[model samples]
Target: MQPFDAKPLSDGDEQLLAALLDGMEAGLCAFDRDGVITHWNSEAVRILGWSADDAVGRRGFSGWAARTADAHDVQTRLLGAMDAPGRQVHEFALLTKDGHRVLVRTQSAAVQGQDGRPAGVYCAFSEVHAQIDLERSIALSEALFDDASWGVVLIDADLRPAVVNAHAARLLRTGRDTLLGRPLGDLLEQGLEELETALQHVLAEGSPPVPSELWLSLRGDESAKRHCWRSGFVRLGSPLGEEPVPLGVGWLFLDVTEAKLAEQEGSLLRFRHNQLHRAGRTASECEDPVEAATTYLDFALAGFADHALVDLAGDDGRLVRAASTPEGSSGPCLPVPVGTIPVAYGAAHPVLQAVERIGTVRASFGALAAAEPASRARIDEWAAARRWPEGTVHGLSTVLRSRGRTLGAVTFLRGAGRRLFDRSDAAYAEDVAVRVAAALDLAQQLG
Candidate 1:
């Protein structure tokens, strides 16, 4: 590569200097120590509506560029930069060639001579409104990265975090320096593919018009389910290029997890309540009370769980599996034979726990997250040992009571794909158990 200063003025250096000055985004002009204009670029002419031929060689903006009264003070302040130790800034109202007034902000500095003394002053200026706009942009950026409540991150074109603001770092549960350059997969347990796809789309086609909601599982926490975020993106491009060059993506997001959970809980509650109402209407038509009891279980399994069982306490103090959902699934629970043997439940099983405590008992899979092939095999063995249907990972067993007597227990089962039953789920299950216990009590009285 050739250096910029490889050529002297005799060899086209003067033309190069002129080209550099004219290509600048800001207006430029130079004056001699006596305050006579010696140079003016095209931008300077564009700003004041004066061509170089008319602006250069002018002894100062006395009658043409400025009001005669203000011109003297403007000239004194501008020229004083020649003796000033550093660049000096001033605001002046100058006249354009069309007789219109323009207020400009300028920075003036002394131009050194060959003998290292101040020979002249060179000033660069822009419209005052434009200067204020630039300052406002800088201030907004500082505030967003420092004090904004939500997360803000700059994702480079490579899709790694280039800059993470303080709020973003805290949300990510790491320091700003630690998050930089880390791949999205390392930070997210799930949803990494979806997030990277969105970023790639922004780099190729620009930001989407509408915001997106993503459910993300971050790596640091294991007890939590997926978190919800309402995110907006802006595609950043280089302003200096003739054609827009993609720089990165600006990602802003607010944590909407609590709101999202509340919304889901409300929807689920309405659904479960509706299912209970529907079950009551349907069960009233059944001639046999045992069939009515199982009908309630079928309705409850619609969204509540994968499978269920009803075990009734026998006269011998043993529990018999009197009703259960079909092995394949989605079918109604069927009644077992009258003389069927008792279920082989151990002393400490969740169903037994519910009967012993006369309350709901919840149990987790006790399996690792991100289950590998070996871990999955172990889970299968664990499920088989518990005698639950193939993939059961969660259980909520509630005691069944009719009047003042503890009649039996009803257990709701969930597969590996579902979340563990929470307090709300236990409450719903107990509600279903109450209806089933009433039907069972009626069947015994009729028999």
Candidate 2:
């Protein structure tokens, strides 16, 4: 058997070990088999206001460091770890040198000797509140990554995803592991600049009081569906640093696309309804019913379409242009020239389809409108064949009906830069068509 003094650690090694123990964030102390204090680190001094010189040579935490009534029980529990298989946890009310009482939670493990016999016990401890705070932080992180309803993401300073929660991963349409360390630009087809700018602002200025909305397009899809997300951000800074040093950003977002769209649709419908009411009131003042019908068409054009054409069913069952917005520039709806020829619309035209079915008909150039030069030429020919104005790329034709009889059909046109008309737009156009149809029917009755 080797003697304890035969191969004792060198002074330098002892100093290094002491330095390592002192640098730890936790308070550490060790006791020998005989219950004599053998080690005391700087954290212990900082916690209990006891110097190493005073703490190292003491027996168990009795008289000075613990209540006289509780010292014996606390010592017994700490020393019990020497015979325990693993670490034993306990809480003790410890007394600082200044006579302040601090409740501490401790984990004590047995240290073994050369013969595998229990030689001593080492206990690491911290203030109870600090220990509970650490546990709370870990639990919160786990909950967010596993079961949160909204998307939660941790983005590092380099603007890359560091940690992504399940909800966020699903929203991004990718696996959590696949998104980590990837730039946001790779995931978004548009609005990357706005997102980055918002992130930078959070890192520099801290969190904003209210959540912000961001609309973005996803990559690798041609449907061009844009999504709205209501997002909040918090700047994370290192707790250990003296000055606030940016660690990353915590981003939380909820999908609000449906809600936002509903709000916009409701607002637009209200505006259109108000316009209709105003147009009706203004039209009643005009003595000429034809002029009143044009006034109705003019009011319908605001924020609805770039151009609109009103056709009347002629005696030959063909459509003749009654009123139209001027081409090449914006203008008021004017009656067509007297004795003008009817529009040369073919059988399969959108206007003809609406007239035949007495319902709304939607048409567009489709992919050809956005295609190369050759396909663009085809678009021009397609519009010309329908007798539509040049540069028209999208169209919606709604049948006009009044007094249970089809009055005519009104066609709305959008240029190449505008979006293709959707069902909602068709609905709004139908509402406008009702007013225009009544006005046109009155004109026919008056004439």
Candidate 3:
């Protein structure tokens, strides 16, 4: 690079000045100290349909550009900027080439002479509506990044955060500057590929008409929860380029995890309630009380677990497996007489715990689920050691109690594909156990 050579305004410099002024987006005009127009750019011609030949050397818009009534006030404001310390702002109407009136907003500043004195005034103006539109855009941009309640983020073409608002920073649990230029995968423990796909799609196509619901897991948080975000995206493009150039994406989102969870809970509750109702009606049609118990268990297992067991507290305090849902080849509960063969459940077993406490006991395969590259053989061995099905990873055991007497226990088992049994599962299991126990109690009394 070479230093720019400074010289007095020769013909070459004058041509350079003309090119620079014509390239500007704003309409520009310059007036000498005597209020005679000395320069006019192509933008000024485009705005008011007056060419440089028609505008330059004209005296202060008194005849052509402005009506005679408004010319005096307009010229006074334009020339007054030469005496002002800073730019002067004014809005006035001017006449076009065909005598049409155009409202314009102008910014005028004094042009300094080589002798350090005010030599002329240069005015840059645009249509009033266009100026208002630009101002509104700037105001909206500021407000969204500062005062908006939701999270807003600007993503660059690299799919990394370029700018993050305060709410977005808070939601991400980091400082605004800390998130910048960081890959989204750093913040998301899961769904990184899905989110990146969505961003890439936005960069290629335009925004979708509706917002998307994304379930993401936050990394580095011990409690790793599935957080649902209701997100909206917009593809950003550069306005200066002749062709539309993709900048990035504007992402706005709100955490809707709690709401979605509540909705799922409500839907789940309704489903369980319907299952319970249908189970009772079906159990009523059973001829044998034991058959009624199996019917209820069948209804409960539909959406709850993969397998089930019904162990009745037998004579002499032993637990005999009365019935069970098939688990591959295992059926500790039998074709034998219902009370003859007792299941060999260890003392620390979930069923034993539920029976002793007269409450629910939930157990899961500890740490095995979290281990990377967990082996199917190991899972089988673990389940076999506990006398469970080959793939069982979670279990919920609840005591079957009716009329203040404990009859036995009902255990629901889940495989690795399902989430562990939670409190809501226990509550629903208890409800099923209550009905099963009542049917068993009636059978024992009749016997």
Each model's lDDT: 0.87, 0.87, 0.87
Tens digits of lDDT, candidate 2, 78-187: 99999998989999999999999999999999888877788888899999999999999999999999999999999999999999999999998899999999999989
Each candidate's number of clashing pairs is 0, 0, 0
The model with the greatest TM-score is 1
Per-residue lDDT over 1-447 for candidate 1, one digit per residue giving the tens place of the 0 to 100 score: 112213335547777888898997778888888888888889888899998898888889999999999999999999999888899999999999999999999999998876677778889999999999999999999999999998999999989999889998988888999999989888887777888999999999999999999888888676645778889999999998899889999999989999998999999999999999999999999999999999999999998889898899999877888888876665778898876588888668899899999999998775443232236677677667766787777888999999999998998888776777889999999999999999999999998
Regions of candidate 2 where Cα sits further than 4 Å from its true position: 1-18, 98-100, 112-118, 367-378
Relative to the unseen true structure, what is the C-alpha lDDT of residue 258 in candidate 2, on a scale of 0 to 100? 98
Q: TM-score rank, highest first?
A: 1, 3, 2
Return the TM-score for each candidate structure.
0.94, 0.89, 0.91
Q: How close is candidate 2 to the true structure, as a TM-score?
A: 0.89
lDDT (10s digit) by residue, model 3, range 4-96: 122456778778887889999899998888898888889999999999899878899998999999999999999999899999999989999
Q: In candidate 3, residue 218 scores what lDDT? A: 80
